[model samples]
Target: MSGRAADRWAETRAPSLAEIEALADAAFAALPEEFRTLCAGVRIHVDDFPDEETLTEMGCESEFDLLGLFRGVGLAQSGEVVSGQMPNAVWLYRRPLLDYWAEHDETLGHLVTHVLVHEIGHHFGLSDDDMAGIEAAADDITPSEA
Candidate 1:
């Protein structure tokens, strides 16, 4: 047998929201082109945590309760925009995401995609079943097997 000893290493840097955002962007880009086209105008944001006000408004007892949020008019309500309307926005809570990461074995990109798709499901006024099917289909394409 060889005399070589095993080696160990550690991550020298801590992960930040920006890092997660970059990963999320790549994951989103890797999504089926048709899906990307449909979400072309939507904005995705990453923050360490939601503000106290947002938590209250969202009826969450703790910040970690919310992993992601969709804060804009759905497709059904988009036509109501008269003028000076803001574009759709989606917020991904990084702290919560990290908390989830600690408990799950999946990669960050996959988690972000799951949250993104779920939020987009809301944007399209899709029912729970509809969203489930959409997520299942996305999984078929991407295969969370990673």
Candidate 2:
């Protein structure tokens, strides 16, 4: 490899959990205002990989099989908020997302935004087509734009 290329590679490190969380937060902020308004109590979390229990529940043979997930009641199921409701949560699997990002031409920020929007779409009780549209909208938002 070229000398400068090697030097740059040496300085590169995987994003830490905090960095990934920051990316998610930025991505969320970049969503259209109306969409953000609807996601009142949704939470976003980042982990290196899925836990064993999550793997078992999802029937995943490998941790890399999943990149992100949404866990909670969608808007369609809600009649009214109860006192004991668990806040809706979206999980981003960092390692798997990194793996996927490496294999594709998409930027890391765009991938993160796509995954975040997808999970939020689920929370909004949107269909696959609806989520795809949302992801398309989010993809247009680059890191600089965000």
Predicted candidate 2 versus true structure: per-residue lDDT over 1-146, tens digit per residue: 99998998799898888998999998888787788889888889999999999999999999999889998888878725677887788999999999999999987888898889887887777888987777666666644522
TM-score, model 2 to reference: 0.88
TM-score of each: 0.79, 0.88
Clashing residue pairs for model 2: none
Local distance difference test, per candidate?
Answer: 0.76, 0.85
Per-residue C-alpha lDDT of model 1 across residues 37-121, encoded as one tens digit per residue: 8776789998999999999998999889999988777785663544677878788898899899879998766788788878877
* Candidate 1 residue pairs in clash (backbone atoms < 3 Å): none
Assess candidate 2 and give its lDDT: 0.85
